[model samples]
Target: MLTATKMFMIVFTLLSIIKSVTLSACDEQEILDISDGELLPNGDVVFDGVVYENRDYFINNVTGIKTACPKLVINKCCPFGTGYKTRQCVNITDSFDAPVWDRYKLIEGARAREMFRFRIGKINCTRPYARVLVSQIGQLDWSDNWHLKSDGKLFVELDSSIPPWTVQPPDKYCIDTFVYEDQDGKTHTRLDALACFLDETPPNHFEVRSTCMLLSCAFILITVAVYAWLPELRNMHGRVLMAYLLCLFVGFILMASMQIMLTIDNITPHICVVLTIVIYFALESAFFWLNVMSFDIWWTFSGKGGMTSKKMSKRFCAYSLYAFGVPTILTIILTSLEFSGLPPHPLLPMVRYQGCFLFGRSKLLYLYGPMFFLCLANIVFFIMTALRIARIKHETEMLKSKESAMHDQHRKDKQRLLLYLKLFTVMGINWILEVISALYPDADYIWCFTDVYNVLIGVTIFIIFVCKRKIFRLIKKRIKENFTNSKNNSEELKYKRTIPTRLCEDSQHQRGSVETIRTTIGMENGVTAEANTTIL
Candidate 1:
C-alpha cells in the first residue's frame, strides 16, 4: 500500500506539471489575433504618402466610398491604441474629385475585397476635390464594419483628418470606440481594430472542460496527501479516504481529457467521461463499505457485535457487488445508449459539442448520487456507535456495586471497556464531522476545525496508549519504593523498642540465677556448721 501510494504521488506530480504547462500554453494561445494592425480583406490599401498632423484617418474601400469632403465632418475616437482613432463621417462632400481620391470598388464574384481607401491629390490638379461615396452594390461591403456596430453588424465611415486632408469618423459613429484627452488638452482618436474574420465558430468545449477537470484532479491530489501524511487518520480510514480521492482523481482526469479530445474533435472523449463517472460511483460505494469496517471495530469492542456483525457482513458483500459489478454494467448500458441515439441525457447525446460531459446534465448523477448514499451510510454508522457506547456505559454502572469476586473482575473489565469506548467515541465524532463536511462542500471551515479535533484526539490517544505503560511502571516503582521504605522504618522502630527491653530482661534473669546459686551454697555451709555443733 505504501509503495502504491508513493507511485501514485509521483504520477500525480508529473500530471500536475503537465497540466500547468498545458494551461499556460492555452492562456498564451487564447487571443486569436495579436498583431497591432487592423486585419482586412485582400483589397485593403496601406497608404504612405498621406500626411496627417495630429488627426487620424480610417477608410473603408470595399463599398466604393470616400468621405474627404470639407462639409463632411469627421470625428475620431480611439478604442484600443494611442496611435489610431475611430472616425465617423458627419456629412458628405458636394464636389466629387477623382485625382485627390483613390477608390477601390468591389468586383463581382470576387473572393476578397479591399478594406480601406485613402485620398492623394497632385499640386496642380484641375478639379481639386474630395468626395467619399457609399456604394450599395458590392460583393464585399467595407461600409458594413462589423467591429463598429452596436448589434455586432458591419458598418464603416471616414473619421479623422491630418494637415491637408484627414479622414475622420465621428465619436458617435461607432459605439465600441472611445476618445481620451492628454494633459496638454490634445485629443487622440482610438479605433477598434477589426479582428480577422475567420468564421463564426465556438471554442472547443472539450478544452474548457479539460481545464476544469485538471482543477478537480489537483484537489484530489491534495486530499490524497492529507490522508497519507496525517497520523490521526488510521489505516482503514486512510484506505477509504485514498479510495475516494483516487476515484475523484480518475473521474476528473477522464472528464478533462474528454473535453480536450472533444475540442480537438476526437471521438473517445465521451466514452472516457462516462466510464470515469461510473467508476467514481463504484468507488464511492466501496468507501461506505470501508466505513462499515470502521464501525464494526467499534461495535465489536462495545459488545454490540451480534446485530452489527450481521448488517456489516451483508453490507460488505453488497458493497463488493456495487463496487465491481455496478460500474461494469452501467458502462455497458451507457455506452450502448450513447450509440443508439437514446442517450440518458440530451446534453450527452451523440457526444457532440453540445453533448459533452461539461455541458451534460448527467453530471448531476456523478455529483450528487454517490454523495447521498455515502452520507447516509456514515450517519447510520455514527448512530450505531453512539448507541452502543451508551448501552455499555449503562451496563458498567449497573454492575459496579455487586459484592462478589466476579463483580470485582467485572468492574475492572468495565474500566478497560470504558477506556476503549471513550477512544472510539472520539473517533466516531471525527468521522461524523468528516461526513458532514463532505456532504456540504462549502463548509471548508468546518472541515478544517474537524482536522484540529482529529489531531487532538489522536495525540490524546497516543499519550494514553504509547506513554501509558511507562507512566504506570514509573508510578508502580515509586509506590513500591515508598512501601518498602515505610516497612523498613516500621521494622527499625519495632526493633529499637524490643531490643533494649529484651537486653534489660536478660540481665535481670542472669542476676536472679546468680542469687539462687549463692543462696544454695550458703545453706549448705550453714547445714555443715549445724552438723558439727551437734557432733560436739
Candidate 2:
C-alpha cells in the first residue's frame, strides 16, 4: 500500500510539471483569446494573424479592459501576390520572417500601452510589402496567418469594398497616381490631379473663353451708354461717373481674361501668365486713374481754387489724360517686354496651374508696389481737396455781406461746387474704405457692410442728381406763379378803394392828354436807357 501511494504522488507531481510547461508555452506565444463582438481599441479585435487598424475610432469613448487594449486586430493578411489558401489554420512561429518578429515586438509594446502603432517593411512572403499596424501583436498574428499554408502566403479580404480607381485614359493622364497610408494603417489610393485640365470638354473651354469676349462686349456697350447719356450724366457730375464706368468696364474685361486663363488645366505658358499679370496691372492702373479723377473733381469744386486764377479746368483735363495715359503706356511696354522675353523683364516659370501667379518675392514688388503708390496718391489728393473746399467756403462767406447780387451768384456757384464735391467725396470715401478693408480683411466687418452701402449710395446719387434738374424746374415754375398772383392781388386792393366821379372824369381827360405826352417821353427815355444799358 505504501509503494502504490508513492507512485501516485510521483505521477501527480509529473502532471503538475507538464501543466506548468504548457501554460508557459501559451504565454510565450502571446495567444490572445479575445471574444467576438468585443470592441477592442480602435473598434477592432485581435484574431488569428490579421492586424485590424481602426480608421474611425475615438479613443476617449472606450472603457474597461478594451481601453487597456488600445489597438486590436480585426483581420490578418499577407502582402500582395501571396498565394496562401485556407482561411483558419496557420503556424507562423518558427518560419516567420525577421520583419514579422520585429512587428511582434511592436505589438507587445502597444499591448502594454507604451506605443501607438507599428510599421514593418519587406517581409519575405509570396509578395512582400511594407505594412502599418495598430500593434506589433496584431502584425505577428498576420504573419502567422500568412504562413498557414505551405505556400507561405496569406490572403486578407478588405472589410469594405475597394473603390474602383479610374483615370482619364493614358492619353489624357497628365497627372500621376500615388499610394499613401493614413493614421489608421489603411492605404489610400489617389490620382495625382491639378486644379484644372488643359483638355477640358469643348463646352467648358468655350464657356471659359467666352467669358472674356462677353465682358469685352459689355464694356463696349457701357462705353456706348456713357457716350449717348453724357448730356444727362453731365448735370450730375458726369465726367467722374464716366471715368468710374470706364474703369469698371476695363476691370471686368481684364478680370475675365485672367480667370479664363487660370481655368485651363495645363496650358499656362509663361507668356500667358505674364500677360495676365500685365492685364492685372492695367486694371489696377485704371482703378487708380478713376480715383485720381475723383480727386481732381474734388479739388476743382471743393472751393480750393477760391478766386485764384489757376486755369483749373484745363489743368485738370490735361493732368487726367496724362495720369491715365502714362501708366497705360508703361504697363503696355512692361507687359510686352515680359511676354517677349526681353532683358530686364522677370522670367517666370510655368507651374501646376499652367502659369505662375503673383507669388514669392516678385509678388510684393509687382502687385503691392503700385497699390502702395495709389494709396499714397489718394491720401495726398483727398486731403488737399478737402482743405481747398474749406478755404473757398470761407472766402465766399466773407464776400456775401458786401454785395447782394454777387452773393447770389456766389451762392449758385457754391451750390454747383458743393454738388460736385459731394459726389467726389462719396467716391473717395468708398475707394479708401475698400482699400482699408482689403488690407485687414479678417479683423473687421465694416468692409462688407460699407461696400453694400456704397452701391446703394451710388444708385441713389444717380437717381437724385440725374432727375434733380426737372424737379427743380417744376418747383421754380410753381413758385413764380404763386409770387405773380400775390403781386396782382396787392395791386388790385390798392386800386379798388376811393375814386371821386367828377374829379375822376376831369382828371381822366387831362390825364389822357398828359399821358400821351408822358407816354411818348417815357417810351423814348425807356428805349434810350435800354440802348445805353445794352451798350454798356
lDDT of 2 by residue, 1-536 (tens): 56998999787667545544544454434533333334555555433333323431212212322112333211213322121222212222222121211211222222211222211112221212222221122243222221111111122222211111111211121111223456797854332211112222223332433353454445444443643444433432355446555554555455455555545543335545555555555556555665565465565555454433256456656756765776676566545644564332233321112233443333445555565676667667656756665676687665547567756655554565555456546555755665555456444465455535444443544543444665457556656877899999888866675446666999989877775665566667775545444443
Off by over 4 Å in 2: 1-244, 257-278, 298-317, 329-365, 398-536
Stretches of candidate 1 above 4 Å error? 1-241, 256-319, 343-353, 358-360, 365-367, 397-536
Model 2 lDDT vs. the true structure? Answer: 0.43
Give the worst 10-residue stretch by lDDT in candidate 2: 158-167
